[model samples]
Target: MRSLLLLILVAAIIGGIFFAIPYFRAHPLGQSTNPGATPTINTTATALPATGIGTIKAPDGESIGISDGTVAFATGGPGGSAKMQAADKLKAGDTVSAQSLWHSALTSDSGDAESLIYLEDQHVLNAHVTSNTPYVTIVVATMMTGDNASVGNDNLQGAYVAQKEFNNSSQLAGGTLVRLLVANSGNDKLYADTVAQQIVLLAKADPTFVGVMGWPFSSRAEVAINTLAKAHIPMVSQTASDDALTGASPYFFRVAPANKRQAVLGAKYAEQSLHAKTAVAFVDPSDPYSQSLERYFAQQFTADGNKILATEQYTVGQKGHAALPQLLQNAESKKPDIIYFSGYAADIGVLLSNLPTSGQFATLPILGGDALYELNYPSSARAGFKHLHFTAFAYPDEWDVQNLQSQKPKF
Candidate 1:
């Protein structure tokens, strides 16, 4: 019985993909802070046969598919002669310089390479494969929308790093091909279902499809998890923090500790550190992650004898402060010591920015859940803000994780 040793690091950041979104600093500037790291958890599992044979195409031509033989990003084509030379060098065994050249080509303002996206860096995953070697397969299913798929693009870049790391690790991987596939599960239920279904089919046909990596948020993960559950293939996530995913499925595993754990931590802090007796929750009904975290935090806090002041719900598009007056009024009545928010960083930022405007309400410490972890700080903070607290699973500095994909035979 080969048990798969799966490991995940607890942090707001995942691997090379780091985002600085919104969240108030609940802890002091230095409270044994961790920039975050994902541990390389171990699982003793039998190696299943895997190879690249079947196609996992997306619907409506809205996917990022790049075979080894193919070059460049899906959104852009491969570059010029110099780029090809750099590509050749990278293939020939020089990564640092070749990657540097590739970076230069991407950075160039001159007509340079038209098939290159300035923000994307997944070419390493698309490196050519000329061998007939058996390989291990991993898929990264992330988003490709929302402002040029900003978050998704970063995750894609991170996957490329994984591919590179796997390819280069000497002791870790003796000599085996690590094939990587990418799918765009654009923040939706049905759409994610379609992409996930394809992954299942791919796993069925291609025995090498060992596991999957993304489906970033809880909503997307909900569909993907169900689809992959049928195949019994595992998925390791860095940032999706829905309490439902906590040991819910054998096929679903997370590197970061779930939101329930985070909520409990917050509750402990409220009871001892802040000495809070009352609390309220701000939830986004549209987001699975937000709702789950909010519920878990409130439950823990209430269990600790904290009064449930009020729980207010809202949608994603609704700005943070749109209902501030009423929320303030409720807070005033309950007079909670800490205000809790559970949602995306963007929405949370709005509330954090506007909290100071509500007189006495501003003085009360505002506490938030893990949705507070992400990059978008410049936009999240208001001009005149005092203090806000947010929780996170991990920090990037805590882990030295890498991604690498190869096409070599196993030793």
Candidate 2:
């Protein structure tokens, strides 16, 4: 109970587009304890299959499940959420949200870990392991350095906890044992590529390797997916929110919704919850995740009858508030009600700390997406920067966790 409580405050906390464009939509986590205060995005939720596995079957023999998702036991029991809505196809602007991948790998077309999940209905874990007990390996790829490392570490802890819990439950269910592989990408783009290459090499070296759990950044996940695709190894990410990745690779899967969906949520939060009419957006064109979000926020906010005064673009490497003078200029000229950011928290934290220096709109509400869930925001930013508000996913309660586990993919 104590550890679970820590997970909630530390790592537990924590999408989609509008209209006839045909976008993917899933049930949003109503995080607030207050029923009325909870944010809602009306999406659909379907029941688990009778097979009692997380893997969803497609027209083909292929199976799939969302991963790199989230879980929180804060409200008693575990609740899990992936970052995406499963769809056969989704189209918005120039983007196409790809259908969930369900390709047969080795013996299983579904890359999901259904056989490995703990089922609520049965009250036990169900799985099919090779005769050689603990034969397959589920590797976790994450950032282990830089400001993002803390988030990655927390996620890694979850993996360890999951490994232990799954193993114990599997034993009771009369299933095979499984092992885990923890890989740190060093948080460098180039180094991440090297790590991805090494991961594939390791997979080749070990016949027992089966699937991967993640590489948190979309950029890194893409790099790893390129290689994993050839080897037919599957990976599920918890936080990589790149929208273009929807159809990018069959070997890659995300438990979280894409960035576009989160962008819509951000816009909704700003408009309906905050009652903001005009806003300035800070975007990074070089980052696919950030770029996709800029478009999503603009589209949804405008459609809702609100205005985005001006969008200030920034590069991925721009440290501190060095690049914000132009943004501040836009904020001043527009006198917007809020400033929207669609990038990582480290950079945004710098901007928030520098807001007073912007000389205008310093106290304006700062709205963002899940990136604002950065654990260090409060300590890293100025005292008044609590104005930081973002649209983040909430973990399911324990009841939801059982339902989610019962439905994840199986071998």
Candidate 3:
């Protein structure tokens, strides 16, 4: 009887301990000891893939499609897709519809720079391509999106005007029509080499492709020029002015003066015109054009018995922007008489826009290279600087008949 009672007591104690374990776990040492409250356990076991997210598609779900005499690679947003549609329409010989789409695309929220190719130019190219009349093609390779799009549009306008004039006149033997093919190289011409390769393929397949024009940036222009030169194609750039591009290729030619000449001209203007003795040079070292201009300008300025108080280098994107405040402080500490910016308008515009109007930089003259010609600063931002000057390859008012006659002999 005693042994059985002891066993029964042990079994009861074990059961009581088991019951108390769950109660302690649920209530812990806190005051909340509700009988119905039980601890909840989440059993979800879904795991994220090791490869992470897949490739992101464009917002508008459009892909770049290249065709003979038509190239559509502008893929940013709605504006890009709309322009692609416009290209399709133009290829189908629907000028009216294509022009309408193109106009709408320019005004869309995608911030596409206005294109200069008009209905007449599109019709001319289309007509020449389909008709049997002998025609020579000139591909205009340029960045049709991002900050440099305006310059690209200007290049297209110039090429179109030339094509129109040539096709209208009896210049070509046997009445050969002039056809223009536009090749968009994307923002800052990041895809310039790839587009150049496509242009080479086009030239190989079609003998009518005679030349190319408008390589706006020197950073990627060297590679593109070399590729085209290897294929025996001639290229002419209206804006690329890096000194390194002087002998990049035998087929490469430029309408703009090299960086060395432009830098010397800028330095002379600063010393003679502005009477500046000390300057602060702000350059984007990542860009070949900016670096070349900065190097040459510094050399010429020092050679002319002037001093560069500080040479601050900054890139062109977010990292560069983040460093601007520090760069400005450093430049201010140097007590420069003038500021020389050897960067594109995208960066210089931001720098000037945010510059305080009452500081030492207010009245300090800011002289920049030809890249500053594209500056589109707001009126409020323009008020921040008293004197802002930039060099230009040409001035419209100076290109009169007399000026042309005087300059013709030199050319």
**Pick by TM-score: which candidate is best?**
3
Q: What would the per-residue lDDT of candidate 3 be over residues 1-85, giving only the tens digit for each residue?
A: 1111222222222223223333333332211124343222121122211221111112223221123223344445567676667
Q: Mind giving the per-residue lDDT tens digits that candidate 1 earns over 145-180?
A: 432244565565555444445556621233544555
- What is the clash count of model 1? 45
lDDT of 2 at 405: 68
Candidate 2: regions farther than 4 A off: 1-135, 171-173, 317-321, 357-362, 378-382, 395-411
Q: lDDT (0-100) at residue 374 of candidate 3? A: 58
For every model shown, what is its TM-score relative to the native structure? 0.64, 0.62, 0.73
lDDT of 1 at 383: 45
Every model: Cα RMSD to truth: 13.8, 18.1, 27.7
The lDDT ranking, best first, is: 3, 1, 2
Where does candidate 3 have its weakest 10-residue lDDT segment? 48-57
Ranking by TM-score: 3, 1, 2
